[model samples]
Target: MHKITIMQMLEKYPELPPISQGTVSKIEKQFRKRGHVRQLKKNPPNKLSDDQKLDVTLMLEENPHTSSCQTTSALNISHSPFSAY
Candidate 1:
């Protein structure tokens, strides 16, 4: 409500984490502008490109029984993506 204070808003939404008045104001402004509050997509710096992913899939198809570590080592890629599978 226009008449409600920030403290009143906080009390009304007790489930929300403790936040600064500035943060709450920013959130309210963003919601008013966009009609929703959601974080922007953040792509991982080391995420494989489409070509790299295709290469990995082809490698996996060729050697279906290879361990994740072995496959990563053979492909010269980090273990994170391979381990995710």
Candidate 2:
């Protein structure tokens, strides 16, 4: 059996996205103590899904001249799913 340090694993997987050394060390220590690490999923509660939010962001970005009243109306229409009880 082989025991590998995170620094060694990171060196071998440099192509992975970069995280601060301190954050990585903290996660590693938690994993060692708990025998596993729980990661935050790409999605979170109380927020619109990525695709839905992206659509609204792009719409506003491409039409920066849109009025606040028009944006509000569009948002109300697009997010009508939440209006149902």
Candidate 3:
């Protein structure tokens, strides 16, 4: 019986998306160790809450020309939601 290598399997499938062989090896290693292929998604630490979102929206509605910096400063938060982009 022949053992199919990562490179050999990748080469066998030509239409697969471009990915480094090293990455595939790491994923295989991670799955073996953790029994999962993907890591848990961590929520952004600086994400705005519903009330904060409403505040920003209301502020914008009051003044369309208001910048994110101005809105964030008025809302008493340091991080700008726009800055994340």
Candidate 4:
């Protein structure tokens, strides 16, 4: 069974109807579980790696007074995961 990474989806399906990252992730999960080809299995969106997250975290830890919003900006996080949904 071929494992499709998130990066693959965004690249291959440029014409796929616009969808949210959450939705794309959800579908990818199912596709992996079923070991099936997904519609968006090519050119997936850019996702942050663990290393990137760690780098962001470390940067924040180094600065005590950094605002969460500012940190997020510095980390290139488009949306605040902590913000109220």
- Tens digits of per-residue lDDT for model 2, 1-85: 1234555766888998655667677877888998889864685334455665665677779898976557647765443432221
> In model 2, where is the ten-residue run with the lowest total lDDT?
76-85
Question: What is the per-residue lDDT of model 3 for residues 1-85, given as tens digits with 9 covering 90 to 100?
Answer: 0125555666887788656667777878888898998777988767777887888788989999998788888888666564662
Candidate 4 clash figure, as a count: 13
Local distance difference test, each candidate:
0.76, 0.62, 0.74, 0.64
> TM-scores of all models?
0.44, 0.28, 0.44, 0.34
Candidate 1: how large is its RMSD? 8.1
Off by over 4 Å in 4: 1-48, 82-85
RMSD, candidate 4, Å: 16.4
RMSD in order of candidates: 8.1, 10.4, 6.0, 16.4
lDDT of 1 by residue, 1-85 (tens): 4336566867888898656777777888999998998986888756676776887899889989988778778878888765654
- Whole-model lDDT, candidate 3? 0.74
Estimate the overall C-alpha local distance difference test score of candidate 4. 0.64
